[model samples]
Target: MPNSTKRGRRILAAGARTIGRGIVRTVTRSDAGAHWARVGGDWYETLGELKGAAMKLGQLASQYHDVLPPELSKQLARLQADAAPLPWERIREVLDGQWSAHQWQLIAEIEHAPLASASIGQVHVATLRDGRKVAVKVRYPGVAAAMDADINNLGRMLRMAGILPFDGDSLKAVLEEVRERMAEEMDYQREREHL
Candidate 1:
């Protein structure tokens, strides 16, 4: 019923489809690894598209190169790359909530498309009234609130796949650290002070 649940279900369905397709394909002796690679690739692609905690989990999984096979780590590492961007209309709503009419007047132009997208946010190019260009990072709506659920869903999915390299305690610790970092990243004032 929750948004994260919906996303998790969608990811599971996609995985099921990938496995089904792979099973239907004639498996040669040497193609077994290729089959797993395709499935892993699909899993990482879904995680990348989901972003949020899902992408974070992929990033963490990628770090277990010492424990996992090199090929698996290499495939999962791709999840660390940029994710798909949010639409301009959604970004506009976020800006509307953050800025009043008087504050908005200070920005002369904001590009509809984002310059880059990360797990939790995206950056856009904006021109100030005085013609100074700046990068504005916008957080995805409700991502902070949904962080825990996303992590839980991703962990469950990975465990179910029998591909989790870390033990439960280690996974918990890593996820806690990630949550803290995500919170810090969302704090624009903190970042400004640091800068």
Candidate 2:
């Protein structure tokens, strides 16, 4: 289990490195690297695969694109929520865990593909048996653990590279706040109720 976890981290780090390089390349040449990080033929799919703090950072960057360089802004603005969906089998498993089999059947048509994907969850368009159109948001399993590990790894790397502006304690506090917000975002029920 420990070995598998380490392997997963290494894979994720490699992906992040690829994304960082792609960002640099895109900045250097506007059109050359437009499709630098694509998944399922969509740029947003690549962002979804990152699935943690990295995704959040990308979303934030996109939101503030007006303040960014044109090249960077363009690339970040393409960070939509349409991600490669999980398999129907996996979706069924999650549904089974969240609702009874009969309740699951009441969903007339849950899109096999996700309509939108973010850091913690993906959204699907569905129609209920009662003929109501609803958006179903499902949280990804183990996202919190993955996100925490990745953030910690990034902070350590940045500090070691002398790139961080603040001291370790201050940085930790900031990370704690970020983690709390991410935790809130992960709660689908809470979000639904708020909406």
Candidate 3:
């Protein structure tokens, strides 16, 4: 088979495995003399679990709704903002790391629960001591580490599955991009400065 064909098959297999294992339900279709299987589920959570390239793929799939079954498209559309909020304790811990106890006390009120949660962070509504309302964004627990592991594993998996062309220069460029992004993301202080 051609390299592109092999790569396409590998991508499909990876996507199928990801969908099958994540929050999905199996659907069956039957004709007068034939049967077929379909899969459907919470696209958002499935994409979130896949993360990185897989999540990007899901988003891309959503764009081509005419080519995808309704169930698949609907699920992928749901992924636009599908995630559970992190617990309040986790939020507090992150805040504690960023603020002193006195500083926390200066905040008149902070929502115990997050107002919203996404793959990387959660947002909380807070009132400062001066009676100013603010929104706090707390990065999810170990997200940087998880992202690193996921990216590295995905790269290895792509290489092993022959999904990535074996070009050393291309791979080096990819790794450099990953490293730059990861480094920036891992620095809370830098993020604060950027904000």
Candidate 4:
């Protein structure tokens, strides 16, 4: 995960380029397809690397092809729920922190590779010393801080760029919902209960 400042710049820079391109495209009356594709690529690269609220928003937005440009939606769809998994070293750090020494010792074997990867966490299959297999979901490091910065920055960036279709009230409502969902997703206990 990037430090907050670097992440902020990455997202803001993408939004700035998108705004600049939109302006030029509007004035030139050029084909929108390729222009939109480049815009989508910028967003995809930025959000995929960040892997937080904005990326989640992009993934959901990808489904609404009628509302979003097809090219943009296409790129967003690439940031699927099963995003690129983090390496074992990163996952091990979380496990080391969360599990007691006794709990850690119970694992006879654990796969470094994840069965699934999401914005918040990933599931790895582990075998207990007693020979029972279980799936463990480990939260990514720095996700809470990343989500916090992302939520704070994304709306302002979009509004400043004049990119969102909604007005202030509507945008506020949308952002509130994003916040709520982010909260829900981050709560591991709640997720387990719901499941």
Candidate 5:
């Protein structure tokens, strides 16, 4: 089989596993059995694997302990600290595209390894031409392209799981809010200006 075909099959299988885990989680209430713990573990693993808007949504949802069951909130909160970091090659691609040779010349040193990583981007420790240490956040390439599809898929999953309101208006508003915040976060120039 072609490499692309194998990659596609792998992606699909991973997605199916996540969706199955989600279903199990949503159906298993804390009072039902100790199986909820397994559900939580599955959820954590799935969200860690899917480190984009899906993970972001999980982190956001975890904040609403008052609205969600304490057990569920605890499970989702795990996503906040746990996410798969982008590969070094992917991180390098973003840095290379953003900084030209002239710009890179100004940097005294840049750590190849990430200092911190989140859903939208990762931060690296860098010493500038001025010898001031700073943290540089590099947005993952293709995150913008994948953002919409990921959000929509997550929304559908949440709605189906009865975590999000089924009402169209409320769901629309929630999704819009997520999109706006994600867009702002991706805007490095805007973030720099704010900083």
Candidate 6:
């Protein structure tokens, strides 16, 4: 993979505040289940679009059935399977940089649409020259370089929004864990070796 051309993320305070207000409203409403469902959907959509630390944390948090409201967790679980995919154009040019001419020749075809998408990458179905099907995982253009910025900005935004219910130091500790996990994820070589 070549160095990324994309820039780091910056969370807007106003946006975070808006999301926070919605959450507060949901919690206070009589129709708590309905409101939680809506909040979860909104969260899944928003975090999926962000495609970085935000989405990663959303996915992680969605799994806590005991911790989060059931309605919210149900919607949030979609992040693991159905998060929005990046367009093929967003990653196609970088394919050349990822492989040599001869290596590229071994690929018979690669589908434009992703099979699945997550915080750091998307998976595409591909065919090799030998006619075997394979899955290709493509990292987003800037996700590796932007991980730290994404984490910091997300932590600040979530805190300001009152989403995480943590003090600064506690949130800092959690974000640090996310950073370490994402850092490991960014190293495809290490992942491949483990596989």
Which candidate has the top score in lDDT?
4
Error of 3 at 36 (Å): 11
TM-score-sorted candidate list, best first: 4, 1, 5, 6, 2, 3
Please state the error at residue 116 of candidate 4 in Å.
0.5
Candidate 1, residues 1-195, lDDT tens digits: the string is: 137767868666655655474556555344656665776687677777777767777787788878865666788888778577889998899889988999899999999999998878899999999999999989887677777777776656554555656677877787778787777877877887898
* Better structure of 1 and 3 per TM-score: 1
Model 6 C-alpha lDDT versus the unseen true structure: 0.73
Question: What is the lDDT for 164 in model 3?
Answer: 35
TM-score of each: 0.82, 0.63, 0.57, 0.92, 0.77, 0.77
Off by over 4 Å in 2: 1-8, 11-48, 58-84, 162-170
Q: Which parts of model 5 have CA positions greater than 4 angstroms off?
A: 1-33
- How would you encode candidate 6's per-residue C-alpha lDDT over 59-114 as one tens digit per residue? 87776667677887887788887767777877786686787999789999999988
Per-residue lDDT over 1-195 for candidate 4, one digit per residue giving the tens place of the 0 to 100 score = 787788788888888898899999999998898888888888887887788787787776677677777888787788885387789999998889889999988999999989999876789999999999999988778787888688768888878876556788887787788888988888888988998
Q: Highest TM-score: give the candidate number.
A: 4
lDDT of 5: 0.69
**Cα lDDT, model 6, residue 178:** 90
Per-residue lDDT over 115-138 for candidate 2, one digit per residue giving the tens place of the 0 to 100 score: 876666677899999999898887
lDDT of 1: 0.75
Query: Best to worst by lDDT, what's the order?
Result: 4, 1, 6, 5, 2, 3
Error of 5 at 105 (Å): 1.4
Query: Model 4: how far is 31 from its true place, Å?
Result: 1.6
Q: Rate the local accuracy (lDDT) of all candidates.
A: 0.75, 0.59, 0.56, 0.82, 0.69, 0.73
Select the stronger candidate by lDDT from 2 and 3: 2
lDDT of 3: 0.56
lDDT of 4 at 14: 83
lDDT of 4: 0.82
List ranges where model 3 is wrong by over 4 Å: 1-73, 155-195
